[model samples]
Target: MSAPSHTTSYYAASANDKNLRPALQGQVEADICVIGAGYTGLSTALHLAESGFKVVVLEATRIGFGASGRNGGQIVHSYSRDIDFIEKHYGDKAGAEMGKMAFEGGKIIRRFVDQYNIQCDLKDGGIFAACNGKQMRELESKKALWETHGHNNLELLSDTDIQKYVGTTRYKGALLDKSGGHFHPLNLVLGEAAALESLGGVIYEDSPVTRVEEGAKAKVHTENGSVSANFVVVAGNAYLGGLIPKLQAKTMPCGTQVITTEPLSEAQQKALLPNGQCVEDCNYLLDYFRLSGDGRLIYGGGVTYGAREPDKIESLIVPKMLKTFPELKGVKIDYAWTGNFLLTLMRLPQFGRVSNNIYYAQGYSGHGVTCSHLAGKVLSDAIQGQAERYDVFAGLPQYPFPGGRTFRIPYTAMGAWYYTLRDKLGI
Candidate 1:
């Protein structure tokens, strides 16, 4: 198999450092073997390595090459399905347990950056912009709900108050979560990989796992080599492909587009985001934008349900950006790209065991940025004989899309269209 390079995007271009890790070459042994070098895998590897476990990580491409590297970089709290849904579906006790861990992902990310001194262009604060009164009410309700979970760093901004943070008239109000923020994602993941290596963990890039031979001891086979370990973790997410047939039906890959504009003048930057905080609207098919450390406007929106790329992503996204900030009609797009994120049928992440010794976690839906880091801790805990946190996710029911793999894309696409229309109508 050919080695893959990082996608052409702002994160790749501004990456603080690159890891030219060599591919797997021969048979190896470890206490644990991890597949994929994205946030979840690297986080799990780092945590376990710190716990004195001999771990090895294999990546099909570069570290953070998946959604971790290419996402909007907004580190929001909770899952895509929302805490209320969890309470209603799983009962009060389960929901409260989940809410307790909800804010920890961001904390873990901050701890990693501070502990390792990772230079990921970290920033502070994120806003949930509301486009209408209905959404504003929703934001208020969301703020209240989150506050009940002990998340106190939340502020509800009215239409008058929102303007100080964002330069857009499209939003009626906003919810400001000071704990939520943004960063240079690629650099952060790279930093984690380096930290793992420094802790005596081994990582091999461009070594895609062809298959996992499951048994008392799971053997992970790659194109050039194999790893026989007491435990195996599959963290490939949307890019896992057909390595495990059972996982394919449980998660579907969806694509989202993003574009970064040429650096704006200091005045223009202030006019757009005066506080330099990341902002994402309340719409289901939402628009998210923030200023790069260097002053470029990085905006992303629109979803392709089947993981299909638009021939001209810039054309598809620029109109949305201009609608939010019409003053940017003349801004040149410096980079445009799309990446896939795994979406479960219920919009919640799916976690379960493929075999007693073979564990997997994927389908973060659209909440991979922060949740993936949290998931790493959960996976590591489960592996280290601490199953309390992991079982919370594993116990949640994950169902296949209504129509299964063959028709799931079209089914979900129709649902997105309906919600997109509802968002437009402010319903």
Candidate 2:
């Protein structure tokens, strides 16, 4: 088969990085070798490069080919599970450690953009719109909880106040996080990749790893070449496949579809989202929409429990868009696509070492954009002998789907069915 290129999303069409590096051929050596060139790999490599480590990146496909490039682009805070869940399950100390890191991802993103001069059209502000009274109360609780954790930039929005930010009535309330924001995700990753190269780091695209020969020195074998290094990082999220059988049963890939409307008039943009903040509604299977840098509205939702792509992307997402903004009834959809995010049974990301020196961080559920950046920093810290923060995530217990991989889809679908019913009934 031909080496994979990017999907036909808007980001791909507008991507600034078009240079394709040569695939690995002869064996090479580095201080650190990274597998997968999405946010996690690129971020980890960039951090190490800045610290004067000789880092090499191997990509199965193009950089950010996974959900990193094709996501909703919102820099949401926290994990898939909340701080309360972490505190309740892992104890207050763990929760406090996790809490302090909750908002670090967004900050890291801004620093990279500012320091590297990346042109990802970074914007500030994000919204968690509540669909009903119950969700509103949850938002109220969320604001209070997050405040206790030192995130005080939250403001609760009444039904009328929500209209000022988002021109919709579907939400009874909302929570505005000033520190949270959105941007062109693909460009951000590409910029970071370029930054890595600027610091003498190497990235080989189209070089998929076949296996890893473990021992005193870890050798990552690709189709045409291999890399011998002291350490290896597996940042391949959902598209990782079965290269490491041990991780096969630990995560499942779920597809979410996105659609972009043709450029709207300035008036229309104002009527839809006046402040131009990204909005994610409060629902079990929620909908998220944001204004693209080019003035088009990017909206997405609806999970395909399994990794299977749906037949009609526009049909699956457009109605949900209209439900939120009825005035956009006849708007033309410029682009429609789907991407997969790895989901863990516990909804927390799986972070740990594959072996003594092979590290990995995956399964961000629906919050890949922000958390993946955090993964890069924490993973790099471990390589630099600062494993305290990394240990916090690594120490979390990881479990496979109850019935294993084959049955995970059906099992998760049943649970989603329960919550979706609650969403519709507003219970």
Candidate 3:
């Protein structure tokens, strides 16, 4: 079957640029060959290209076809697991390093937007809405914890004060992170691919890798062609399937749905997100929403284990959106879509090597937006012999699901249910 097109999405409808990269049909060679054209692959290819390396990226589908194109577009800091958890599980030194680097992903994003002049409707300030007192206390602790890592651009908003940002009575409080924000995610990845091409990086869309031969030089076999490179970076993340058995065992694909309401009137937009900041509620199963450049309210929530998309994306999302903004009940939904995010057993990202020359980074566990970009930089650094920072993640322990691939869904779903129950009980 031919590779699919970009999924029907608000991002696809509003994307400013599109490119049809030819499929790889013959043997090609590069200093580095990257599998997957999402954020991690594109970022790694871009960084390598900027450093004057011969880089080639292979994408099974269109650019940003996965979560990169389908996400809520929120630029949140840190990994799927918080730094506090890292401090507890790892150590204070590792925790501090993780915290220091947590905010760097947002910085990398801002730098790319400014340097390349990528027009992705970049916005500043993101709010973490607390739905209850317990969440509020967590936000308070988060503020102090982040401050310890030199992140001082945080403000705690009381229940009434949160109304100045989000037009919702659902939150008890909020944490405003000036350093975090949102943008057009699909355009950001597309722009990064363009930047990579301008630096002489090659991209092959519709090229699916079938196998990888590892050694001093890695051979990546695609359907109709192959790429031989001094190093290989496997970055397919959630959609990788079983290309690598060990990786597939270590992660599960979790699907989430999103919907875009028809462009709201200026008044409606103002009344919704008055200060124009994106808001994500504090829930184990959270809801995130923000305004589009053209004024659509892009709201997303709900996770389906085992990669089963909800029967009705809108049915699953619209009600949740209404719960937060009942005023939008009369508005029609213009678009709805679903995308899978990779979830690791440990919640922390899995970064390690298959061989000395074959490196893979996956399991962002729904925190790929920023961390994927950070992963790209880290992979590039590791390839270029600057392995200090790379070791921070590569050295962390990554374990496969307890029941392996077959039963990980039920195991994880049960765990998520427990947390969801806790969120509901305000525990």
State the lDDT at 276 in candidate 3: 90
lDDT of each: 0.91, 0.92, 0.90
Give a tens-digit lDDT track for model 1, residues 91-158: 99889989998888999999999999999878999999999899999999999999999999899998
The Cα error of candidate 1 at residue 271, in Å, is 0.7
RMSD of each: 1.2, 1.1, 1.2
**TM-score of predicted model 2?**
0.98
Per-candidate clash tally: 0, 0, 0
CA shift of 141, model 1, Å:
0.7
Candidate 2 lDDT trough over 10 residues, lowest sum = 305-314
Select the stronger candidate by lDDT from 2 and 3: 2
Report the poorest 10 consecutive residues by lDDT, candidate 1. 305-314
Which has the better lDDT: candidate 1, or candidate 2?
Answer: 2
Model 2 lDDT on a 0 to 1 scale: 0.92
